[model samples]
Target: MVSAVLLAAGQARRMGQPKQLLPLDGKPMVWQVASAACGADLLEVVAVTGAAGEDVGLALADLPLRIIHNENWSNGQASTIRLAVQSLDTRAKAVLFLLADQPLVNKALINNLVKAYRESGASLVVPRWQNQRGNPTLFDLSRWRTELLQLTGDQGARGILAAHPQCIHYVDLPGPEILLDVDTPEEYWQMQQLWQQYKVTKG
Candidate 1:
């Protein structure tokens, strides 16, 4: 079964406050991400919280998820990732790693990724927009978990997977949603505007 891991342990140093707690369109950023991850098919959602663990936990209280605290979150992204991976259930065959700041990514995009992974037989699958790779990257648990656990720096699993280039599969993402991440107040506002525009266009 495919599982979703939401990485929410960042310090939000640049943003000056907890980015995950910041609301986008009336919902907390992390909550939005949790909803999308929970909506994926064959996925058990787990959220890794750090920085302001108490606040994040409160925000996520309504969601049904296994929350893992990254005590070493100040160590950087790699630390939180390792904590989350180590905490995953043994029954999971594949795990999709997603970022909390990506509130713009929706349920449909995550479902597409899980569906493609099941059908494509790829060891590592990432959503590709133009030439840039984006979030919600999936790693086949049977193959990549050990190597992923060995990762130490803040780069996450990209460098390890890149070493085995042939094993990577790129699914062309339908929109810029894959590339958008709200890191700052300005970016959040821009995303809100973009979301409104998108809703209007779709309607």
Candidate 2:
């Protein structure tokens, strides 16, 4: 079975506020991502909180999922990833790593990744847009759990991907949502504008 890990522990130093709490269509950014993860065909969805643990928890209170708080969040993304990996269900065959700020991720993309992983049997599976790798990458626990446990610093799974290129499988998908993340105030504002346009177009 596949499990999803929503990483929501970043300090948001550039935006000067918790990006996870930022509103996207009247819901918290992390909530939107977690909601999608919950809707996906996965065995479990785990939300990892760090700097904004209390607020993030409150944001995702109603979601039927597991929440984990990482005390060593200041150590960087690696700590949050490790925390989620450790908290994952032992029955999980693979774990999907998701970012809280990527509000555009949806259940379809997640399901597609899982489908690819099941068929390809690759050690790692990730979405790629125009040759650029994106967020919400999946790793086979039986294959890479040891490597992931040894990771440190801000680098999430990039090191592992670099070290084992042959084992990586990319699922080509359209759109910049997989790569676009809200990091700074300007970027957040841009995302807000894009979201507004998207709503208008959809309606």
Candidate 3:
């Protein structure tokens, strides 16, 4: 089973506020990301909340998934990741990690990565657009479980990807907007614009 993990624990120091609760398409940003995870082909969907844990919880309360609050969230992304890994379902053979800030992450993208993880023998299945690696990466838990647990402060799974180039299976996406993430106010605005474009195109 491939489990979907939505990492919604960032403090958003650059945005000067909790970006998780920010509105996107009439729902919270984290909600949209988690929704995509739930819509994916994964068996289990887990969301790790931090910073504005309570508010984020309320936003995601109606979703069909489990919530994990990380008290040590302030420490960094690594702590939240570790907590997420520790709570994975025993049957999960691969874990797809999604970022809450990337509201543009849709079900199709996630499903595509999961499909890659299943078909490719590589340890990692990542999205790339014009050579730029993107979020919602799928890691073969059976292979990278130790590396993920060993992650340190502010560190993410990128370290493992960088260390083992041959083990990565890159799925090139059509455009870069599909891989965009919100960090600063300007980035959020740009993402909102992209969201509008997507809505119209898919409408």
Task: Return the TM-score for each candidate structure.
Answer: 0.94, 0.96, 0.98
| Residue pairs in collision within model 2 | none
How many backbone clashes are present in model 2?
A: 0
Of 1 and 2, the candidate ahead on lDDT is: 2
**Model 1 residue pairs with clashes:** none
Estimate, for each residue in 1-203, the C-alpha lDDT of model 1 and write its tens digit. Answer: 88889999888887899999988778898998898777768558889999999999889999888898988888878888788788888898899998998887778888888888889999888888888878889999899888878778678877866788788788897677657988778987888888788667657
Global lDDT of each candidate: 0.84, 0.91, 0.90
Q: What TM-score does model 2 achieve against the real structure? A: 0.96
Clashing pairs in 3: none
Model 2 misplaced stretches (Cα beyond 4 Å): 200-203
lDDT of 3: 0.90
Candidate order by decreasing lDDT: 2, 3, 1
Question: lDDT tens string, model 3, 51-112?
Answer: 99999989999999999999999888998889999999999999999999998889999988
The per-candidate count of clashes, in order, stands at 0, 0, 0
**Model 3 stretches with alpha carbons more than 4 Å out:** none
